[model samples]
Target: RDNADNTYTESGTRKRMGRKGIGKLAALSVAERVKVISVRDGDKSGCILSLNISNKNADGKYEIPAIPDDQINFLKIDETKSGSAIIMENSRYSINKTIDSAKRNISLIFPFACQTFKIHLENLTTGATATIDDTTMDIVKLSDALLTFSDEDSEYNEYLNALHGAFDNGRYYRVLQEKLPPDQLPAQKVLHKALTTIKEKMLLVTITGEQKAFDLSICGWIATFASSSDKKRNTDFPVNHISIIANDKLGQFDILPDISTDRMGEAYVVGQFFVDLLEETELPDIAASNRQGYKEDDPRFEKTLELIRKNALRPILELKADATKEKNYIRDLEKANKAKESKEAFDRSIREVVEHPDFKKVIHDSQPVKQALETAWELKDTLKDTYKKIMISHSSDDKPVIDELERVLHFCGFEKEEILYSSSNYYESGFEAYTDIYDYLKNFFVNTTRKTDLCVIYILNQGFVEKWDPVLEAGAGWVLNSTWYPMYTDTFSSVRRPFPGTAYTPKLNFDMDEKQSRTLAGAIYRISQHAGKLEQTEETIFQFIKTTRLYHG
Candidate 1:
């Protein structure tokens, strides 16, 4: 068209959609020849023009021939109309020739254009027409396309029905029963479950801000998937990407490396940032020649990068960590539940075997009876030393401290039966209200033979010295020549010495704060290792020593 000469010009002063003058070369890049037809207002006729883009002379110049007015064909034109048409021939570049593929590519590249412009497409051979608008590119349509399985027959329908049933009723096993004929149902079920997990773990965040430095309005949404598989299935887009869009067109597809080097975090994240300022004519041009990326050193680019890091990347990392923690917690609960079930099953089997009629008969036989008695004797001897390895002596008033110490011993790998304490067994045997304190202590230490072989840990406080039973317990320890480790509280400092010999004791203050409690835990752990009740390792011992110094400082 006569008005279309502006596109072929080298430069212009007015604002324009495209700045480069070489856009017309795109036609040559695609086809070997191009034809142009035009009509203008007030013109009596239309004119046709052609260019041989593929022709070249020996001097490497295109051989474009000039056509005289006599050679040009003219047709009647509408007086009030003006328009131009272009036809490319002998295309050199690949293109999506199908109607659907072409439509999709146009929708993805110029979504906003499809909404504003009256674009109509027609198949010349079939006489079929398609109209594209905003609805044609809606995300809902995309989601439906993704969910549609390749097979359209009843088998795929059954799979979808089972999936829906499983979701509605929370009965996956029932759905698994409705397997497909070709045994593809299990794989589908796995994919469905993985997708469900992804939905459960997915995180979405929206960031909106006005950056005054660039005078730009920025808005974006970042979403994370549960697994790499889920992400791959959901999109062919690059993983862990932050796409930058200007005027609804992608300028940069990925900025992940600029944000962080955390590969584990990158796999789950994908998003886009909309900033129309990059397309403004008032700003210095930063877009690359091919329109694929921005100049790295541009101030606008730097500011946008900073905004994305602060608002998007930080929150994504935190959300990912929280999701991982929640997943681990669920897994641990499932494992514990399974272990409980296994234990119950084992106990039931043992009871069933013992109650069998044949088992009763075997028990009554002389040979079996003799063997059972011998086995019982052997078991008793084997556990005898193990049961008397550690004796814990404390006043009842110090129960809290002793309880905590018992926990520490367990943490250091001591079993429940190996620990001997007065409150656990003494009261059950009616020793709590015994009239003679020394009698109880003498029987507990001498008759049991716990004093000579076992390590005795004394929880020393004012109550231990003031009360007769605790003093008698200490006297018993002296009589049995047991190895004693004193754990003294603040109350013990004000009381008279129960023993004459002066030796340093590990001091603990009552009503301890968190740090002090950790120190006490460390101290108990160390004493247990020294007394041969816990195994020793250099790393464990060093950690304990470091913790013990917290209260001291």
Candidate 2:
């Protein structure tokens, strides 16, 4: 206890994390008595410590009681190794409570869990034991990108390897937008120079009341960035933090609040920095009494914060910005290519149907046939896919409900290609976005063959009844005499025809409830039966609908 002071000289290579004697009193909070046992220089020793805050001696201080050596060795101490253990006796909570809380709490306080030193918690009552190790950190598990800075060569190489691994696996960026040629991207050498520059700076601070200068340098740190901030589910501790570690012990849980600019980019950032100088005994104690963080006014801490803000955090944000731009550029290119390919496929399908043997073998010499063929040319622009048995007609604003409707269709034994929705990929029949709407509808309803085979599900809402596009789709479905069903939310009731005609059938309710479930299931069953595609039983369909939530809006 006498050696516990501001200066540490216990070990040449390792710095002690606990210098104050306050930690020895922590067990007294939860236990009436504690058994201390140790093995040093092949000699075994034991003692019993008992403290009561409510009781005080005549000297106005708590009295420590001593017990026999036999009573102190309650748990067998291993004399084979030089070590120490304190067993809290008559604790307020039992080992069962410790088992539940130890894993997460211990991992947080002692985050440097490694194979060289491992802490195991065992329940003496049930003989259940758990070990805390390096895997508990989960720092590198699901990170999108990581940058490590260290002055040492081995540590720097290790960090470089991790960065390269993330890049190669396509996890370095949420979206890999590298559309430009490889030559255009920054070379690895240039990036290495830029990233490694973080460890080059040193901080100089004057020791208070001594007129002596102290040089401070960062030991190492790891910075992580993720695409999403919802990483608490994957970690045992608070995420998106920049913790400060001094002498292998956590000095501050997070320093980001003090140093951050609070930019949107900061949401993706998380890291830890190590600065042993914060705990240097030769210098004045800069850490707060709680030992959780350094004094804000301390020159040493202020400089360290400035160093991290400029060198460590800023570069990662710049890299994220560059990666995001690249991602968007590549996405645009892919969309453009997809649209072009769809347009070409639409042209090919129309030409194939128009030049079919049935249409080509007509007697052109007849005046009536010639006039009919001429009329057919004007309506031949309509697109058709015989495999598409269902068409979902709804306003673009009602996409959410249409999504649920698609799910129901899929559950009822319909493939993605067997249905058509303007917003979905199944509507690849033509360039619906670029083509003339009136001409396309005219050819689809009035010229297309086998109108009775198609079934349209119109999702009726205020957006649908008021929008010109959805109204046109509804009118086309009616004119073709195609089997159609109208579903509406509370926002609207009856369907208003696009051309002033009325639909006689009642609109099915689309709210998310038991009644809607039964109504939707029955409608789906009947539609499937009409299309000769009935696969799922009515009960099975109802059960599936029970698990899903339909429209609530």
Candidate 3:
């Protein structure tokens, strides 16, 4: 099976054999869109066939309707050969396929395919692979191998095409449905229409796994898919079986969407679908949960279940309109004659805080200070929230260590915007290479985390303890260190690691009061932990933060 040297007339014991169906399935099991081609031995020509399944057609009813000649960009399939020789270009045919940081990952899963074809997956952002075997891989054979006749989603698209109603769309749902932004996803009508269909016509959907890393345009597709469809007596689309099977619950394993014996299967299917996507995707998990209020079989949520049942579309719209009107009325009243008095009261508060000796010293750094001030002002200007954002305190010498720390935060579900990077463009003057150190402290008075949450600190070897003025100043400041601050090693924030002949020393130095990773993770797990729910300034600026003293030892 390793080589194809025996594919000729056998004089004594030589023989030829064809490829197995298992290989065909392996080729088809790819994550996204896959096209196959083939050319068998002794054939003069070959053909091209593209067989693909997408989250767009999770209901399993759609197929390649034939690409219009004008829309064809980079493919020219020849249908004249028979010995099987196919070419796959991992280019623009897909975005997730274009290589980036996860190159080593893709190759590990498809090693045989990679080695056989001598294809190398390069950068995670834009790289690809090519495979060549003794057997020809032409388009027609490849397509045939991937194609599976499925009629399950026959009414999928049609039912989805008409889901407008009183709960999902509400009164304005129809009007807004017609007014989707020009750059939005396709089949707006169908997707919205499926919202209230009682026949259970939707199925064959995909979540694509990387929903956490894509653009809003793509995420919108998943939102629409999850929203508009009415729960059918027939089914709830399972989250498993997609190219990306990261969904933690509800596949073909435990229950079928159509099982008549279990009435609550629908709840399990939908709730688990959400839990799976919430694992890493960037969707609004809280809002989605709040609206539907469904989760792992909790009886206490009976009221939530009632809301889900009564939901049609119009009532939701009514509620949204009422909320918006109430917000506007409050704003208008504030803008009237009462505005001048309120402004004086507000300005007095600012002066009282700024003029206080305690605040004056807590604020005012040469680098992070300026940016913090600006961010604070913006937060105050838009007083919708009480606190503005989460501020991180770090010294310039600890850039590399802090950089790595940032990566960890993002890895564990924290957003960069949620945690202010003191090294960003906060100061615009003599502090060009060095942003103002005092900006953040000035902003602290307005709303510490209105624009963000969960402030963190990165410590480095001899950086802070060795009398680094910036770190020392920050540690003693009021606004920067106001509340819960989880500290990390300099390497967590720094970009550099052990240089040429060094001892590979990576250590962070700070207080000795820090707790375990789990303890800190619970206290400051992510930015969302404190967003739209509470103010960041709840903790005193003078509160003592638990930290760990570090050394090369």
Best by lDDT: 2
Write down the TM-score of every candidate. Answer: 0.39, 0.50, 0.29
Candidate 3: residue 514 Cα off by (Å): 17
How many Å off is the CA of 500 in candidate 3? 36
Q: Rank the candidates by TM-score, best first.
A: 2, 1, 3
lDDT tens digits, residues 190-283, model 1? 1111111000111212123223333444554444555666445322334446677675556677777777534355567655556655655444
Q: What are the per-residue Cα lDDT tens digits for candidate 2 across 1-553?
A: 1133534556655667755756656677778887777767666677667765455689997755444545534244555657777877898655335564666566666766667668787777878778887532365555544556654453334544444444322542324324456654433221122144243333443334445555566644444444574454433456677878787778898888887754456676777667776777666677687767889998778888888887777666555544444445456457647855876697699778667877666654577976776677665544543456777787777676667677667667565665767766455533356777676566556643454556787877766668888778887887767778777654334455542323333234445666656667777888777666666766667665654456343
Model 3, which residues run further than 4 Å from truth?
1-239, 242-388, 407-415, 424-435, 443-461, 467-469, 479-481, 490-520, 526-553
- What are the root-mean-square deviations of the candidates from the true structure over C-alphas? 17.6, 14.5, 24.5
What's the lDDT for candidate 3? 0.33
Off by over 4 Å in 2: 1-9, 25-34, 41-62, 74-77, 88-101, 123-128, 135-137, 153-169, 172-194, 197-208, 225-230, 234-236, 322-332, 335-553
Q: Between candidates 2 and 3, which one is better according to TM-score?
A: 2
Q: What local distance difference test score does each model get?
A: 0.51, 0.62, 0.33
Order the candidate numbers by lDDT, best to worst. Answer: 2, 1, 3
For residue 534, model 2's alpha carbon misses the true position, in angstroms, by: 44
Give the Cα-based TM-score of candidate 1 against the true structure: 0.39
